[model samples]
Target: MIYGVVNLRREATLPLVVGNMNKQQQVIDTVIDTGFSGFLSLPSSIISALDLPWSASDIVTLGDGSETLFDLYAANVIWDGQYREIYIAESETEPLLGMALLYGHRLQIDAIEGGSVKIEAL
Candidate 1:
């Protein structure tokens, strides 16, 4: 298991937007999941703010034995002292960062354990 001190941010919800594509702006919230697998989620309030080109085409399985459709988009994220461009799936509402990105990042929950996890960029 990997362990490290991570920087977390509570992003503000903004409309989905692709400022570089020269397409219509998509307003979306800024709440990015540190461990999220590329997806954009928002409340109705947030979606209403955007100029959606079309509905999302992907379907995601939920934890409650159900499935829901999520929106997907290309987003630019600045984190861990670096900037990255990733595709984010859209949802109505969800928590920040899931385990997928966490595992990919090799992040470990560091408490006071003697064999705590620490991560450092090379």
Candidate 2:
């Protein structure tokens, strides 16, 4: 299996466009939530600011309880390093990198020798 990991810093939240029905949603910070099972977690304020359109979806897990926040969409793909669209999502979760992303691209993670996280693409 091709596996890799990257050193994603909180300060490096990617800025991309998101929405449904071809509408561009708000630009929010998307943290690399490898711990959780969601693709992206849009804060209540961000959801309100973007005026996102959503319906009742399956609740996603945060830890002990479910997340009661913005709606989730089918973001099966995202902007690549060069800003190219790529399919990634396979699992449905709130603001997280589900198995789909980790296994879809066959990526692996490891500790960097110099106090950094390394992501290797297979």
Maximum-TM-score candidate? 2
Name the candidate that leads on lDDT: 1
lDDT of 1 by residue, 26-114 (tens): 42334334444444444444333443334346777766667777765554443344444444455656423443333445444333323
Off by over 4 Å in 1: 1-40, 44-56, 110-122
Write down the TM-score of every candidate. Answer: 0.46, 0.47
lDDT of 2 by residue, 1-122 (tens): 22223333422223345554445444433434556554455545545454445544665555667564435544323334323222223233333433434443433334442232233345
Candidate 1, lDDT over the whole model? 0.42
Q: RMSD of each candidate?
A: 7.6, 6.7
lDDT per model vs. reference? 0.42, 0.41
Model 2, residue 114: distance off in Å is 12
